[model samples]
Target: MSDQIKVKLPDGSVKEVSKGTTALDIAKGISPRLADAALAAKVAPLPHNGDQPEARLVDLTRPLEEDSELKLLTDRDPEALEVYRHSSAHLLAAAVLDLFPETKLGHGPSTENGFFYDFYRQTPFTPEDLEKIEKRMQELVKEDVPYAREFLPREESLERFKTEGDFMKCHFIEQFTKPDEKISIYKTGKFLDFCRGPHIPSTGKIKAFKLLNIAGAYWLGDEKNPQLQRIYGTSFFSKKDMDEYFAKLEEAKKRDHRVLGKQLDLFSIQELAGPGLIFWHPKGGIIRKEMEDWMREEYLKRGYSLVVTPHVARTDLWKISGHTGYYKQNFFTPMELDDAEYMLKPMNCPGHVLIYRDQLRSYRDLPMRLGEMGTVYRYERSGVMHGLLRVRGFTQDDAHIFCTPSQIEDEISGCIDFAISVLHTYGFNEFKVELSEWDPNDRKSFIGTDEQWNLAQGSLKKVLDARGIPYKSMPGEAAFYGPKIDVKLVDAIGRLWQLSTVQFDFTLPQRFELEYVGEDGKRHQPLMVHRALYGSIERFFGVLIEHYAGAFPVWLSPVQTVLVPIGEKHLEYANKVGDVLKAKGIRVEVDGRNEKMNAKIREHALQKVPFILVVGDKEAEATSVNVRTRGKDKTETVPLDSFVERIEKLIAEKKPTLD
Candidate 1:
């Protein structure tokens, strides 16, 4: 064994220290301030055979015996936040044990926004109990108890947990570790359990935390098992950050598409029709028509040939596409036909592939853009469905581009432009993109040869760089078939929604042996790109509802102009105005309900009519109207002809605002 080891810091400097020097010792050697700020350390040990070291989180106080590169993580680092939240979960479990000693603990892990722990107790935890548990948590934090990690023989650990009636912990230990191997456990104050943790130094580091709510969850997510109390909570580095998160949570609740869908009367999911299926009501149908028409027009303008495909195909077709072998889990059950078996198509790739291979094509037709508003049906777990976002059936604005290697980059660039236009035209200007690249180390998770993957990834990166578009690289997020680019749009209240995708599939083209004749009269396999601007019509509509809070722009509004007459005397003039709008292809309606003018205006406002034109006796005689735009308190009067011209321009431009 070496007496001294060289430890490399993030800044390329190395320190010759004793072999067992811990990360905390290194931090304190540098400065007490660095030691104080750090929550955990990410270390990559020097590999013995020249292989790259795998970076993993470790306790700051854990020993660094070998030559390793170390990074001390603080709140500023995104990874440290995850460890902080995980430690907060430990704090929550400690508090729960302190208040109710008999309750057994389950797994507590950090979620996307927060942390949750499942507990089994004979008595259900109530709102008041949550308050008490939170108070106890504060007390535990004040005590500054350390999260002490220990290793014990697996048999001994299981015996101890069994003595405490912690069957869940015992099960986890048996499932995750061999009986002969040592088991890792974490202890905080009097509470101790089985865990592998790189927790913060102590409970004191968990500064700001709130226990949000409680719900019931089955053990291991299996309903057949006993139910447990799942307590949800979130923690932040500062009180201000926590408060801002709560405020954002409130805003998200207000903008929930399910609630907005009801208020706008845009869509519904009926019980009779079963779950995970959408029912587009009349108003919603009109909005969908506008969306489809706009997309189809763009397809033609961009030189794409629109085509249609069937909803179902023979199971043999899916088998040929490798969908049955690779994607059978997402497929609906196969139906027994007289001649052969059939299945609902989960994707439009094979259908498009069949079209591409239907006729022999020369080099002049090398780049064929086949587009569709193709409806696909797939199986969705009953519990996972959430309104339009997760559905059993959906129409995709799906398109496939079959181009030669030289033309692949240009095709991707065109797809990106179309995707951006879709977002911008729908009123979302702020967006972030991600390129999902496969992990070369885990080659089993992805397909294609090294050269093919390199060429595809390089082309995508080149197009993004040429366009000067900013995107985050997400390694290992790529699909099994190939790499992809996902565009997530920021909504009105600052929620990110994933809508558009441009994916490269090297597997499907090869599976179908797709080819086009080259200039040399040789059959060459064409590179296939599958892109969906509006990934799914249903999901996009849901995002649109939440993005605009159901107050769609003039071009998307079902009833664009509503004529509200003040009295019966102005009813004739209101009808005439409606006639003019209808002739211009504007969606117009006259609200002649036997109600007060104010009542009519209030109703129309609730419906989110873009323009509510009030016609009274004087206004009708003068051929002018009072316009009350949605979200404004006051109404302005304008000449009828001028109003028509202004609205036509707004609709033509698809302005995000009436102004």
Candidate 2:
């Protein structure tokens, strides 16, 4: 029998260690500096399968029970941040218990943005109480309490939680742990809580942290359950990074689409008109028209047929499409007619499927692309709505391609190219692509066969590699039907927004029973490719407003040029100049009000008009006007005819600048 286990390092080296030796001993043997800096350890069992097992972080003191691959974690690693935040959450709980001895603890974990701890108390936590809690947390940090880990039988843990009157923790212990299992618990000073953790060495390691805010969150996120206080906060490795994070957050707030939308007078959501529905004013409508025009032109240029579909479909249709049963939560209440139940369309896919099956198609007409600006309605939770980004009703610039198996690769490639064109045309210079693939280990979560999944994933990877585009592969992120590619655009402040997706489907085609006759005299199922470049028009427009800060390009601006009269007498000349510009198909507005030239200029500039044409005695006599372009104070005087010609060329070329 072997007394030692062979541990493989990531550097292709192996070390024989005693079977019960812990990861901390291995680190110290390697280097004392590493031992001091190590926060956690990751291990992979030997003889790994194609399924990449999720890496788990464990305490450095955890002992190795078998042969495995070891990876020591440090502060620079992203995974270590989770451990740090979890430790911070513990500090928060300890502080809360010290300040309010009657408070009971709920689960606290690390979020993508930060960490939040939930607490159940008879009375709500006031703002002043939060300040005191924060101060108490700082004191605990100064104390440098050690996080002591221990385990107890499941029954004992439940009994302890029950004795302490922690109903939530008792419920969790009963649900998650088996009777015979040992439950892990961590103790810090007077606080004791159940958890599965790999915390930092001590509380002092948490150097930079701040409590953000407190909100009433339902226990377990269920409205029916008693409410609990959720305190959100963020932590970083250093104070400088935390400061920079706050600075960037402030910059992002300045570019918020909701604020910009109001200031720009672009659109609104009227209370009488109902929530989640948009009312685009004249200025917003002009931009929408331009966007739609460009999209339709591209559809025709790319050999896609423009089709219109109904706004509602029969409930039977949704059942056949498999959405009625699985996606009932997102659908609105159905309307029952005399004969059947009609549902508002939550997606445009089923409509396109009906169109494809309208006629018997042959292999020659296999790759049929149907495009539409389909509007859809969905039921979104009230608290989740955030302006246009998370509205309940929006127009989708959607398309579906029905093609043969042999043509799937080309169709996918074409979709990717089209998405790139969308980014380029919309002035988005940076983007990231993510390929979501099925998890083979979790086969029941998916609907397709292993062969079909393999083929579709290979095709997606091949297309991305052919274009030399880098993408992240996210296992288990795919829909139940098939794999997908989500494209996120990098905004002005470097935050990413998911705006485009190209997905493959095997279940829908099968469910719809769609078929096309092949050249071999056999009927075969057609593959389906669903792609939405702008996901939704309202959301895309919101992103655009934030991207450009309401100053649209020449082709998209509602009032491309404004004619300002320096004095009331110059109104005639301004009208003449406006007429000349309008003749060239440029959108121009004349400002003939009796206001100062500087005031008029300032007002137009504030409106973000691309160009301001000032006509005064100097230019009215000579039949010239002074042009004040946006973002610049200098004025260039030119003849009225010459100025009209310049704007005509600029608008015709669809220039993004006024110059």
Candidate 3:
């Protein structure tokens, strides 16, 4: 055995360190300050996977067993936060065992929002119990117990968990590990858990934590197994950080789309109508019409042929498209019609395929783009629905491009450019693009031949690279058919929402045997590109609402402008001003109600109208009006003619805001 292994640092310096040397020792060798601030280390193998490292976090005291690239994490590193929070979850489990030793353990993971630990016990935890658990966690932190890692054979681990009545742990051990393999486990005080860990050094490393709430979750996320009690909690590096996190959460709750939807009287999902369905009210409908109009104009400008598809199709059509075999879970149960079983269309791809096959086309007719605001239905699991984000039925801004293999790259580039334009027009300044590729090792999870996957993925990558767009390449994230690119926009609150998707499909064309006449006088298979910029109008609208906190821009507001008359006599002048604005293609509504000017201004402000024009004796005599803008404390008086021109320009530009 070699006495030392070569360790590479970020500065391109290599040093020979003795085998089993801890990361903390390496940090100390680098600098005292580095050692003091170090929290964890990320290690990567020599060759790495792709351009980035296949890295995993490990304790600062954990030993490196092989030649590798190593990165020491400090307090300022974002990854340190994940390790800190995960250790907090371990602290929670340790504390729970101290208080209730009989509680059987399940898995605990660090979620995006926080951390949660599941426990299987006869009695459900209550509010007071959560508080007690939190207190005990604090005590454990003060005691400063070390988190020790140990390994056991998979069979031995399963038997241990089973003997302790930890059925969930036993199931996980059997599911994720082979019978003869060694499984890793972490022990903190009396509590032990099977985990793939990158935990912090000790319990004392977690400074601030709180148990938030309790909820029931099925074991292994399957209802067939007994339900387990999940204890949710959050932790931060410091008390100030924790407080800020809680404050941001409170602010987010205030701007929640569900609450704002009810307050603004925009949309609803009626209990009687059904779950996962949307009913756009008059206010919301107005906004929808505006959105549809913009999309239609863009379609014409971009040379897309708008087409409509039926709401339902025969089972035979789905069978022909292979949707019956592959996408059956998301489809609605079949309905027995007069002669055959029909189903509400779950995807627009099959319908568009039928349209393509309805006619024969020459090579000159290639690269044809078909666009629609098509509505489709899907069966979402009952617990997974979240307002408009996840729904049973929704309208998609869908389009499919049929083109020869030679034209695939340009078509994909066009879709990406179009997606970027959509984000910019909607005031989104930041976005992330992901290139999802199939995993060749996981053959059963993906379809199509290796050649087809290689070609499609290469095209997608080339398009992104040619455009100078940086994207994260995610293996095993591709759709069943082929590779895809998904675009996520970062909103004002720094939250990401998936909006646009451009997918390259290999199965649909082969299933339907779609073809176009080639210049060589032979029929050739045409490639299919499925893209949706606004995934769904409902979902996009919901995100926009939260993005702006219900204060929509001038072009998207349901009521663009409201005219408030100061007195009953001035109502005539207000109507005249509104008429002139409306003549210029602006959406203006006159507030002719018999109320005080202040009251009218406040009401319109609450409705988030972009501009409020108040006409009184002073403004009426001068042929002008007082403008009260939303979110502005003071009002400005401007000429009626000037206001019309300003609003006209805003509408013409489709500007997101008046400013």
Candidate 4:
């Protein structure tokens, strides 16, 4: 065997190096600046060989034992950014250990926007402690301590961790490492951790970072186990980027739905009634009614038959639908009944399936669409639950289209049109579409023949292409039964909300034995298209609240116009104005509270009322009212009839803004 190994650079340059030379050595040979900038190297064997030809990230100092292709990673690469944040987490751990030697380490992984590390300590870490920890981390960064990796016998590693009373580490060792395996350990200064890591060369790479906050997490996520202190933090390649991120975070805080929800008195989740269950207050209920009314009207206009299904079904139904096998982790336990086990519905597709199979279908019924505003329940983990975004129970604007293969393209196109209409009507102008197709290599994760998958995926692609819409192709993101298109709308703050989907299904029809007679007099299985425009009503409401910053349009606002009388003397005139607006089918409220005129206007504005009409003696006598619109600084005095006509026209059009 040749003692020299060939190292292929990403730019097509090759270098001859001694077998034991490391990637860092090659980088140094190229340039000292490159060697300093690189955080890690992604290396794969040369000749482009192996069942998995994917390169794996490793420390730059990792020895190259054979011919390989190497790509050095820096802050410019997203993957290296993840590694940088992970190293920041390691620095956090090292800092914590330096400050408190008694603390035992748990896992620390890089999250989407930041990183969090778990630690087991007797004393709870206070805000002051977090500050001290951050201070000490800076000192470690200045030291530029090397992160040395070492291999130890599994038994020795376990014994070492056990000797230090690191029960968490010992448990991880026993759980992950085999008896004859050599456990990889990473040591940063005096802080040693049992981990297989591709960390940066040193701690100095972690330049811009901060300890955000702390929360309690159950050990291994088990309630019965000890709760560990999970410290959250974020890191960036530069100070400017970190500053920009925090600025966006501050803006997000201002638009937070939970805060606005209470301020606007729109919705609430009561504790006694349990979590993830929303009780829409009067104001919120009004908006929800408009939402439901619009949806139902569209259902009729689009030729879809409205249907209602039971909230619970027999466990056998779920079993036959393949949900019991596919989504077992998300299913709630079955309720024991006198006849059989019953289950809360987790989805509405099966209910529609049963409805379609309720009668004989002829070729004329080639395209049957059934729609429902169905409430469903799923078993969500406690820690994973967020406001309305993730909840145990939700109402879905779900519909199912049963059609023949010949009519699939038109049906899919119609669904896309409906979805886009919903977005545009709701004032969402920006959105991203994704086509999720099955992964052929991972056959077990999917449930369909190759022919069925190809046909379904081809139909979705062709429709999108024919419409000239650009979409991201996401492999391995399809539902087990078939492929799908997911539409995510970008809100005002630029956060993407997953709100619509059109999914194809071949397995469900076969499982339910659904059939329709064709023109050729042959019974054939029908194709199923599951479409949900709003995803979940509660979640969509939350998005709406944040999207418009609680300032709804004239049609959707709970109190379209609040008549604020300047004093008790004008109360009669205010009442008259409210009556006139009420007669015209407008939602009007009279603010006759014993408060100052400015206070009344401010209060109504706080509630995000569309119009705050102040009627005084002069205005009342002139048959006009002073109007203060939401999100406007200047007030306009207009004839009561003129204002009514204007708002009525706005409401009729469902305009997104006053102007």
Candidate 5:
């Protein structure tokens, strides 16, 4: 066997080194500065038979025993930050063990923003205990203890953990490793963990980290298992970055939809009505009306026929649609009615399909677009019910199109165009698109033949490519029934929300046996496409609240104008002005209560009213008023007619800002 192996760098440079040399040695040979900044190394062994293996992250100390491609990851790489955060989680566990020796470790993994570690103990951890753990973590960092890795026989490792009262570790070992194989472990000081790790060299590498909070989680996510305490934390490469992150978090808290919803009296979730069910208040209902009206008008303009479907149907319908087999878990409990079982609809597709199949369609009536603002219900677990973003019941602006194979591309392109329009109308300018395709190797997980899958995916790609739109292709992320295109929008705080989707379902058409008479005088199956622009009305409303920070634009504000009378004598003129605005289709409210004008103005301003008009003797006699526009510091006096015209124009044009 050769004693030397070749290491290829990302820049296409290669170097021959001893087989036992480590990645850290290679980095040091390049430069001391590079070695100091390295956090982890990604290595891929050279292909043997024209097949390339995926590159994997490993410890810098891992020995390279074969010809490989190596890339040393530093602070600049996002993947390195993930590894750094995972190592920080281990440090957290070590600190916990130092303070409370009886704590049993579960698992620690990095999340999108930070890391979390689960621990099982009889006594719950207090805030004060967290503070002590954080301080001990600092001490460990000061000591710069090395993260040592070792492996042992699987049975021996499991027996050691079982004797030490670490049942969770034993469970993990038994579940993840074979009895005859070795198990990987990591040790820091006296703290040991059964982990498959590629951690940073030592605790000192974790410079900026904070323990955020703790929550209760069931073991393995089962309600019947013992509950464990999950502690959350975050780490960053630099202090400046950490500070910026916290600042953004503070802003996000201030803009939380739940807080703003109560302050503005928009929406609520009543405990008596049960969880995940929303009750839209009077103020919120006005906004919803506007949203629905706009969407319905667009449907008519786009040549779609509006339809309504029953909220509940027989279980036999779901069984035929295959929802009973794949999506039964998410369905609410079935109800027995008249010796037959019934269930609330979790989707609107089957109902629309039934309508299309009611009559034989011809080629001349090919593209039948059915649209509905249908409300559906699903059973969401108690722990997963978020504010409006996640709920048990919601309305979907769903539409389905049945067309010929030759016309499928145009239909998809049209759906994309409509989705873009929805984003623009809702004041969102930035968006991302993802095309999820099925996996050929996983035949059992996905439906449809190769020809159908290829045709559907190719049509979606052609539409996006022809329009010069950039998208990420995600293989193996498609639904069991078909492939789909998802559109996610970036909100005001730079958070992504899933807003729209256009999916291709060849399975449903076949399952329902939908057909149309073709131009060749033969019966052929119609292609089906399902699209939802505003994924859910409740979720979209929540996004709107956060995006505008409760200060809606002039077109969408519940109260477009509020008139405040300076004195009792001016009430008549205030009402006159309000009536005039109301006649022009503006949502106007007159503050005729016995109160000071400035106080009334301040109250309405707090409600985020778009326009506050103060009418007094001087302004009333001149037929003018003082206008205080939202988000503006200065007040301007303009004639009532001119103010009405300007606001009318703003509302008519659907402007995103008052100015």
Candidate 6:
């Protein structure tokens, strides 16, 4: 072994340093400012074979043991923020332990937006407890408590946690560590935790942090186990960033779909009916009708045959589709009927597959596109279900395309185009695409021959490349049956929602023995592409609710216009105008109640009606109406025909704004 190791910097510079020199030493050697600003380090070992391994985060104080490519992460690095937040979680746990020594610790980890630490105690943590913990965390930050790391024999570590009655920690230690291996531990102040950490140096590095709230979580997500209090919090490198995050959080609260769903009279989850099952009210149903009608029309224009299938099928069908073996956990419990087991369909793919295999297909019918707005049922845990985002029963705008090998690329490109059109029509102008490929070595997780995976993945890549679309290649995110392309859209609030997918499935066709007669007069398996544009209608509706903040586009609004008569004398004219709109296929409502005109206008404005038409003596006589457009203060009197024409154009063009 050499007495010195080589450290390569990201700028392609290498320096020879003594073996076991820490990253902090290298940072200081580069510049004092760099060293002072550094929060953590990333190191990738340069093996003798000259292949560089994936870089992993590490503490600045940790010694570099091999020739490695090193990058010091500071506040500028997004990766460093995750490490900072994780360290903040440790600080939170330490504060909890300081105030309540009897509380047993569970795992603490960083989430996409923040971090959370779980604790088990006889009493649940209160809001006041969170405030005290925050104060204690601030004190610890001032003290500059180091996040000290150490390792001990697995048996000794387990025994220590067992002695302290930390059953959760003991369970984690046993589950994650081998019997003879050493276990990694971190200590922040007086709190010790079983963790494999690459944390920021100390508590002082967490500049701006806040304890958000506490939520109940069953240990290991099993209802049979004891519940733990999970403390949620967020941390940022600067106070300015933290303030901006809180501001966005407040905006998100106002746009929360659950609250707006009730206020807008859109949709609801009835406690008596179920948790995840959604009931579309009259207003919501109208919007859904518009959505479905648009989709079905597009399907026909795109040369897809609309199809519908049964909601329940024999378990034998699932067995043939490989869902019985691979996806049984997500399946609703099977029911017995006529001495045969039946199960609710968790996906629409198998039904489409059956339809395709029903008749022998020829090469001329190579690309058979079948689309459906099918509802499927799945068993979701109670705690995991959200309003409409995560649900048990939802409708998918699903389609399946069975194409020949020669037509695979064209079919994929068509699907991509269709997906982009869906996004554009839904008022989403920004989107990201990801290509998910299978891990070749993970045979147990992914099915199909290597050739099948390569061909399918290559076709998808070719289509993307031809269209000049950039996509992230995500390994191991592929479905068990095949590789896929996922399209995520950025909402108005800059949040990404997974909206569309184009998946290549080869295993299901083989499992079901689906064959088509090729031009060679021989039977061959057709390539199958599974796609969903909306992903889920219910979830898409939820996203729309938040994205528009309950103010839908003119075309999609349940009631396009509401007429408020100035007085009882004008009630007949209001009805007359509403009748004209209705004849033109416009969804119009006439408020003929004996109420003040301003009060009626206010009520319709609260409902987010696109246009509130006021009919009075002038409007009734001139065949005109005063329009109070949503989101606008001024009222304008326009001829009734002219107003109707403008609204018709807005609805026909699907304008996102009323003006």
Q: Name the 10 consecutive residues with the lowest summed lDDT in model 3.
A: 45-54
- For model 3, the stretches where C-alpha displacement exceeds 4 angstroms are 48-53
Clashes of 5: 0
User: Which RMSD values do the candidates have, in order?
Assistant: 2.8, 2.6, 1.9, 3.9, 2.6, 2.4
TM-score of 1: 0.92
Q: Write the per-residue lDDT of candidate 6 for residues 1-659, one digit (tens) a residue.
A: 68899999999999999988999999999999999899999998976676657778999999998889999999999999989999999999999999999999988999999999999999988899989999999999999999999999999999999999999999998888899898999999999999888888888888999999999989998989999999999999999999999898898899999999999999999999988999999999999999999999999999999999999999999998888788888899999998899999899999999999999999998799999999999999887899999999999999999989888999999999999999999899999999999999899998888998999899999999999999998989999999999999999888899989999999888988999999989999998999999999999999999999999999999999999998898999999999999999999999998887788888889889999998889999899999988999898999988998999999899888887
* Candidate 1, number of clashes: 0
TM-score of 6: 0.94
Q: Which stretches of candidate 6 lie above 4 Å from their native place?
A: 1-8, 12-18, 46-52, 465-468
Which residue pairs in candidate 3 have backbone atoms (N, alpha carbon, C) closer than 3 angstroms, thus clashing? Answer: none
Encode model 4's per-residue lDDT on 1-659: one tens digit a residue. Answer: 89999999989999999998998999899999999999999998886434545578999989999888999998889989888888888999999999999999998988888899999998999999999999999999999999999999999999899999999889889998889999999999899998888899999888799899999999988989999999999999999999988998898888888899899888888999988888889999999999999999999999999999999999999999998998989988899999999999999988999999999898798799999999999998877887878889999999999999999999999999999999999999999999999999998899889999999999999999999999998989999999999999999878889989999999999999999999999999999999999999989999998899888888899999999999999999999999999999999999888888887787788888888898998898899999898889999999998999899999999999997
Q: Candidate 5 at residue 414, lDDT?
A: 93
> How many pairs in model 2 have backbone atoms within 3 A of each other, for residues 3 or more apart or on separate chains, i.e. clashes?
0
Q: Which lDDT values do the candidates have, in the order given?
A: 0.91, 0.88, 0.88, 0.92, 0.94, 0.93
Against the true structure, candidate 2 has what lDDT?
A: 0.88
> Where does candidate 4 have its weakest 10-residue lDDT segment?
46-55
Each model's TM-score? 0.92, 0.93, 0.96, 0.86, 0.93, 0.94
* Best TM-score among the predictions, by candidate number: 3
Query: Order the candidates by lDDT, highest first — what do you get?
Result: 5, 6, 4, 1, 2, 3
Model 3, span 1-659: residue lDDT tens = 89788888989999899989989999999899898778789998666455655778898877888888898997778888888778888888888888988999887888887899998889888898888888888888888898888888888888888898888788788788887789999999998889878888788878788888899999878889889999999988888988988887887787788888888888999999899999998888988998888887888888799999999989898898776777899989999999999999888888888889898888999888999999999999978998878899999999999999999999999899889988988889899999999999988788899999999999999998988999998989998898999999998878889989999998898999999999998998899999999989999999988988888888888889999887899889988988898888788999898777788788888888899988889998999989887888888999888888888788778787776
lDDT, residue 414, candidate 2: 96
Model 6, position 276: C-alpha lDDT score: 92
Per-residue lDDT of candidate 5, residues 1-659 (tens digit) = 89999999999999999998999999999999999999899999977799988789999999999999999999999989999999999999999999999999999999899999999999999999999999999999999988989999998998899988999999999999887888999999888999898999888888899999999989998889889999999999988889989998998898889999999999999999999999999999999999999999999999899999999999999999998888899999999999799999999999999999999999999799999999999999887898999999999999999999999999999999999999999899999999999999999889899999999999999999999999988989998888999999999988899989999999899999999999999999999999999999999999999999999888889999999988999999999999899999999999999977788888999999999999898899899999999989999999999999999999988999987
